[model samples]
Target: MLHLQVFTFNPFSENTYLIYNDNQECWIVDPGMINEQECQELFSFIESHQLQPQAIINTHAHIDHILGVDVVAQRYNIPFYLHELEMPVLNNAANTARMFGFEYAGVQTKPGFLSEQHLLRLGNDPVTVLLVPGHSPGSIAFYYEKGDWVISGDALFAGSIGRTDLLLGDHPTLIHSIKTQLLPLPAQTAVHSGHGPSTTIGQELNSNPFLN
Candidate 1:
């Protein structure tokens, strides 16, 4: 079975995830560690668990979600992946950081692109890439069928949804994306969001104010 671990990091309290399998191989999702101390926290966990990080997979390229991408990717010598449409957002990271009063050296590594056409795999297990969009132009979610869960960037939340006032955000599109792409999942499927606590698809469907 695939195992999941979460770390709440940075001033945004973003949730960074480590998805690993029995083989000790893992994919680091949304590495948000912003400083030396935070970086060490992530490294220490990986070291303690002896996890072999294969790649850094992102749900989106918001500044807070990607602050540690460069550090973790370089340290592990692994490739980073994001949807092709988030390129502009990724490219604007430096400016976004500056606006948010955060120090950023900029992301030096290029990223591999993800799409609905492909599946991301760890060992023999496969993860379906769902193009959910709206929170950002290229927002996506990682659905692990075997694990019965999805890492939903900022698209959907427990009782609310992602704000559409940010760059490239559109409220109508976000609602449509959630209804068409995410809400159809099994009710019991767990939703691991980019921020705050985790919730289930059913919980959100029944109580999420935005959805209603």
Candidate 2:
């Protein structure tokens, strides 16, 4: 069975996920722990669970989603993974922090990138990459088909959808990706998003105003 620990961090309350399978391997997704205590809490959870994280992944490169990429990467000695187009956003996290009137670590950097790897080991359970880039230019969601759940960043939400007002955002593209990539999944498929609550594809299709 795959085990998960979700931490709501930062002012935005970005959801950072730690996933592990029965093998005691784990992966951290969107390490947005904006403060030192949050970071410690995150690491502490991993240690407490005896999880050995094998990979670090970001659903997108928005500042809120990636504020602690550098810290997590450095601490775990793992290569960070993000879509190719988020380089600009990754490079400007500090600027975003400044704009948000928050302090930045000043060491924010993009240390890695992702391609369609056959398997992403989240503690022995393999997750497949699904390119659902609608929230941002390079936004992508990861899916573990075997597990019947997806980590759907901002591209999707419980009842609303991601706003396309930011850089490299496009409404039409997001709609297309959602229709083609997400809705096609089994109706009962679970969607774990970056914020708010989790919902199933069927529930969204039946009730989401934005999706309709």
Q: Against the true structure, whose TM-score is highest? A: 1
Candidate 1 RMSD computed on C-alpha atoms after optimal superposition onto the true structure = 0.9
**Mind sharing the TM-score for model 1?**
0.98
Instruction: Report model 2's TM-score to 2 decimal places.
Output: 0.93
Model 2 lDDT, full chain set: 0.82
Q: Write the per-residue lDDT of candidate 2 for residues 1-212, one digit (tens) a residue.
A: 78667899998988999888887878899988878999999999889988887778888888788877778878887778787877777776678778888767543454577764446666456778777766788888888788789889999999988878877788999998888888998998899999988999999999999877
- Model 1 residue 90 CA deviation (Å) reads 0.5
RMSD of each: 0.9, 1.7
- The local distance difference test score of model 1 is 0.92
Residue pairs in collision within model 2? 25-123, 26-123
- The estimated TM-scores of all candidates read 0.98, 0.93
